[model samples]
Target: MKKSSIIVAFIILLISVGWILSGQIPKKIEEEETDSSLNNITDNKIELVKVRTEKSVSKKFNKLINIQGQTKANRMISISSETLGRIIMINEKKGEKIEKGDLLFKISQDELKIRIDENKARLSSARSQIDERKSKLNEFEIQFNSEKNLFDKGLSSKSKFANAKANLDSARSNLDTAKSNLALVKSELDLINNELEKTIINAPFDGIMTTGHMEIGEFVQPGSVLANFIELDPILAIGYVSEKELKSFSLGSNAFITTSLNDKIKGEISYISPIAEEGTRTFRIEITILNKNFLIKDGLTTTIEIQGRQVLAHKISPSILSLMDNGEIGIKIVNKESIVEFFPIDVISDTNQGMWISGIPDTSDIIVVGQEYATIGKKVDQKLIN
Candidate 1:
């Protein structure tokens, strides 16, 4: 009985210690939960994002279109022969400059000359025949008049007068036939002369002879190319313009060009095609530039710049550009409420200073730094660049 009573007292003491420890543990855990709640609240508070921005200024933009082209001779042609003959003389050589009417080729004309001589002889003979017929007609008329007077005065027989009249009529008819024959001969002579002239070919215009297709003693036929001639005093620079840029150009528009040979040429837009090319949908354009020295040759690669009208634009650094989630290029700006905003821009051109752009506001605070960190329509803490 004494041992049992001692065990009960120990159990009671253990219960009392347990109750005290449970009460203190609950209070300590409550304090820790409160502190954790306070930390989470602090973390959830929104913090302002800092960014670097610059106020955009508007400037007049001089639009310029850059295109590549090639230089061409103002006039290029292949001179051909009009008659068939052996080439006997070449007055101008290849690469020689010549003026209009300068004799370029001479075909063998011995046979042609003989034909002309024959025609001339025939013409002279025809003329002599016509004169002889006219003289016979005059003599017959005189005889007819004398016969009629004699017959009226009873000095001649009727048969004789009738014979005289028949002779005069026959003589007049012969003269008419002779005159017709003479006209035919003259026409034939003209044709022969024209053929003779064709034997000597002359330059059609002022140009440089680019080639000599026939050598001495070579036989050439009609339509055979004798040489190539090109006029280069006013060089043509040919190029194409995009459909979107077509409206920006017109005939007589001033342009500047640079060639592969480092030649700077000033020119005017001489021609603009009314129709677009089928494949590229581009319009053709030609610029006329003076090449008096003939230094600019054909087929040289060239770059041209055509100046367009002036427009209002903003200049911004290339780094300031960004892409939206929708894949549009734009710039981020700070609005009047100091909120991040996006404005799409069209890049007009690139310069040493920056990119000249359009389609943005005339005045804007462009976010140069931390643009990616800010969301559109969200407020930001902007740091202005001095």
Candidate 2:
């Protein structure tokens, strides 16, 4: 009777186990079906690269050529003595502002004045001698005529007529000599007057004296430098342009200048070199700016910005720029079909905010974020940035 009870208990346990297995099998099948559905969904839906994009629109961008330069004076000259003399007066001090024709130095004029007076006296004497010689010539001419008439009429001898002719010839020669002497004296007087004028040295233009004046009573000779002068009313900003940039530069174009002292000024392109420099292959350019206050100084460091041709360009942050496999600089953009594309661009100009670039469509969707993950020609999921 115990054995029979055991068998019946085993059967009951097996049936219970089978019931548990049946319930687990359906649950496993349901789980497998859910997983298969998930797999199918994943396989059917294409996974794309996620990226952020910005719509860039092209506009009229005035390209600017920025060049390093320096400030220069409009004109600079070394004032020098044109004659030998002793300095008697100095009218302009170092660093003094001078006007055109203002006397800057005075040399001793006593000797020149004396020479001029002597020449004047000589001239007057020469003129008097000429007058006396003319009178004598007239007298001799009249006597010669009278003698000739007498001789012709047989009233005077041949020797008497010959003597009268000689006298007339001598008188005429004297008059010519007197006239030559008068001319010589007149020339001497003019020379003396010119030397007297040289005793005073005046400013050639409105400028500032950059050098100290010679002390009074100091001797100076011709070609001796007296002072250094510079004209600053219209200053020049001088710069150089590369060979590639020379074609776009032109005379009379507008330019902007910024000095090391942070002084900003507007100017016009006054000069562009026709030939390039021998070694540097660069052309020189000069911008003229009015400096009535004389604040701009020579040799000051400057940056010159000259406006160039207008072009359609897009302004974008430099961070978005990328490099291609061939080492070309470019930017990645999304096409209408949501495919990523790499486009090479030319940098037009740069500013504080962004860089202007060209060589792309007038309107484009540029990849702003996740550009590194973007593959060329691969479709991407783009999100427009606000």
Candidate 3:
């Protein structure tokens, strides 16, 4: 009975110890679970923020601007004579449409014709002399051959054979001289004919002569003003562009205009001078304007406006266009999180309504109202005002 009581006491002590350890185990597990739940909640708070945006592919814009210009002629050239002679026959009258190789004026026979005739006679005489020399040389050669055979056969003397040989050599030398003289005379005749041909002046281009300075029996030399020829259908409108606005235009830029008397006229930049004019410091530009209806005229006053590309669709109060934080002028926009981002855009051109700019997107939703209050990366709700 004493041993069983001792065993029962030990068992009671072990049960109390186990019950206390079990209570601490449940508390430790609950504390670990609470700490893990707090950690999870803290980790979940650290990652990504919410962003909301709407996106859609828009239709491509075909932007057209109104540019002003004038109609101009393509090209104009004056016809001039290459030879110095009097005008004998005026083939085409003034205001006549002529093509290439058309005859204009013809001159009568002058000293040039006489010189050509003389050269031709000289050439014919020289040819006749050459023919005579050839015949004479042939006769001398036959005689020389006969004498040489006789001398070889000891029937003719060496003196007679030498005389025949000398006569043949003389004929041959005369023939060569005649040929050279004929060649020189032929060349002279060709040059005279060329000069005679040049006496007839022809139209150098396809156009109408505005004014004719000479008539029949008029003596004109090279470089003399013969006629003022100009292209009839189109005319030239000359103008100068400012040096500051040099970069505002380009070759082949769009230009348009309308006259009070004429309809709408369209033109493109045809020429831009590489060097600026010294007096005006302005670059000279030529635009090829068309005048098909025969409306445009020379020396007509015209207004020209070179068109450039447009930029920026954001609307702003006209007051803020020139506003500056310090001294630099710029506009501010909002980032993804409604943060303000200020950037400078050189105002290349501006109208009474709005400003055109570069270095900006084609379309931007700018923060015009709260831009002064916003900072970069500051999150705020954006009001859709477009």
RMSD of each: 6.5, 9.6, 16.2
Q: How should the candidates be ordered by TM-score, best one leading?
A: 2, 1, 3
Candidate 2 lDDT by residue in tens digits, 179-226? 999999988888888888998889888888886557789999999888
For each candidate, the alpha-carbon lDDT, in order, equals 0.88, 0.90, 0.67
Instruction: After the best TM-score superposition of candidate 1, give how far the Cα of residue 158 lies from its true spot, in angstroms.
Output: 12
Q: Looking at candidate 2, what is the lDDT of residue 34?
A: 100
lDDT of 3 by residue, 1-386 (tens): 99999999999999999999999999999999999999999888553323222221123322233333444555667667677778888765576666656777787767898888788788889989988998998998899899999999999998998898899898889889889998888888888888887887776666566667778889877776677666645455456776666666677887665566656567777787889889978777776676654566655557765564443333334444435657867765556556555667665545676554544454554655555555545665566554
Candidate with the greatest TM-score versus the true structure: 2
- TM-score of each predicted structure versus truth: 0.75, 0.81, 0.64
Model 1 root-mean-square deviation: 6.5
Better of 1 and 2 by lDDT: 2
For model 2, the local distance difference test gives 0.90
Best by lDDT: 2
Give stretches of model 1 more than 4 Å off. Answer: 1-50, 131-176, 335-339, 381-386
Better by TM-score, candidate 2 or 1: 2
